[model samples]
Target: MAINQKSFDQVTGALSSLDRNPQAVRQRVVALEKVLERAFTVPGTQYKVGLDAIVGLVPVVGDWVTGAMSAYLIWEARNLGMSKWQLARMSGNAVFDTAVGMVPFAGDLFDFVFKSNSRNLRIIKAHLDKHHPSTVIIEGEKL
Candidate 1:
């Protein structure tokens, strides 16, 4: 079985779009990418979408948005019936993002790298693979 105990793939779901099937990964990446675009010129860019302009710079609001997004990932995992340990690991990504994202500018920096949406996507992917290795992630499945 390609099943791995670790939720690595689930945590990295944002990139799943780059995979053969792009549904799950593509949606999450696109949405988060929008957030990054509006918030910064570039996520890590010093002059462009740097972490400074990111909403993560805002203490309460930024964290709320980030948390909400993270919860979506967890909700997906629940629908997939992921194991508790897997869900916890997925939550860890969200928790880390919320906690560190609370920082002033530093949180934005964390968001750039941590990428809660991407992390959640990864968790979802991992859960899918672990639970249903034969499954193919098609766009319609999202509907």
Candidate 2:
């Protein structure tokens, strides 16, 4: 099998352990989203930011590094069997974030506001809720 397929199967298999504990999967997703996009709040402002934005301050290399981190969320969504369209949209968000994020000052500012990982996580949650309801965790209870 292709390496990508093999790695995907491994991820799917690993995630299957949480089939009877959907709350765990939900927790994982939520934690990852926070880490990637909402780890902190700006003082005296309603805005929040995370490590993705922090790392993105290193000029050219920073955006690429964070882009790879963002890809992990999409990879997990694929393991959950999200549709191609949803996956494509998620990829686009990351790509857009990364591309514009390479623009120095403006990119750092954009990263603070764009928050692509959080957006992608929301999309993943919506897809799971609507199409894979079995995997959704609702109010500490597995739906």
Candidate 3:
């Protein structure tokens, strides 16, 4: 499938805006949720909850929200037609970032270190490269 850069940018930019929305503002939540799953519970496994559980140790829910947003991006990638392998890789990065990122002060340290969205962006670009060979990949410079 041909991927349009305009559409891709718009979708991601909109998804990134969820953090600022008031609870009552949910027009895009349902639509974006399909592309992004952020639940307190990880389904089918009683033992495994999610970053919220791990990050709850902090004074506020900083790392938890960070991790959920990361998962959301991975979900967005699925909408972008990324392969399962890419999805796994993306999920793993998010998990690692969230898990290590909850350490008292150390976790926040790690969060600053691991940019999951940048990594996921790379994965998406790579997938696009492999699957959409006809499409030209443009850097900051002119193509």
Candidate 4:
């Protein structure tokens, strides 16, 4: 039991450390953006779709859920000490997505193309690259 407890504690400690690490935050935000905006490719089409498009098929609740997820990215940005203007821009993107996403069918179509999370991810990446250069990820290179 003590061994098991020790392992669990180690895992939780690592996760908590990740919470404070800018690189971990960048990785998390990038993964979330991929999940929200480009999870899978559409059959017979080059276009990709993610939860933002799929879950957005539902009426009100889906938009709320995805909007909350988008807000998480903004929260992480704030934790990274991002400027107010950047935070406001990210918030505006999320709000616009949520607002337009409330519409019935048109909103579903909009979600497939708009990709607000991707936009916000770009913003976060820019900030991280400029301020926390060590967090910048090089594609195809192991860290």
Best by lDDT: 4
lDDT of 3: 0.57
The residue-by-residue lDDT of candidate 2 on 1-143, one tens digit each, is 45798899999898666543434455677888898888888899987889888989999899998899888788778877788999999999999999999998999999888988888989988977786677776686765
- TM-score for each predicted model, relative to the true structure: 0.57, 0.77, 0.53, 0.86
Model 4, residue 58: C-alpha shift (Å): 0.6
Among these predictions, the greatest TM-score belongs to 4
Evaluated against the true structure, the overall lDDT of model 4 is: 0.91
Q: Indicate the worst ten consecutive residues by lDDT in candidate 4.
A: 134-143
Residue 131 CA displacement from its true place in model 1, Å: 3.0
Per-residue lDDT of model 1, residues 89-121, tens digit only = 878877877888787777767666666555566
Q: What is the alpha-carbon lDDT of model 2 when measured against the actual structure?
A: 0.83
- Candidate 2 RMSD to the real structure: 4.6
- Which parts of model 4 have CA positions greater than 4 angstroms off? 1-18
Two-way TM-score contest, 2 vs 4, winner: 4
Candidate 4 accuracy as TM-score: 0.86
lDDT of each: 0.61, 0.83, 0.57, 0.91
Q: Report the lDDT tens digits of candidate 3 across residue range 1-143.
A: 98799999999899776543222122232333323323334567543233344444463466677677777667666766667998999899878877776677776555444556566766765665566544433462322
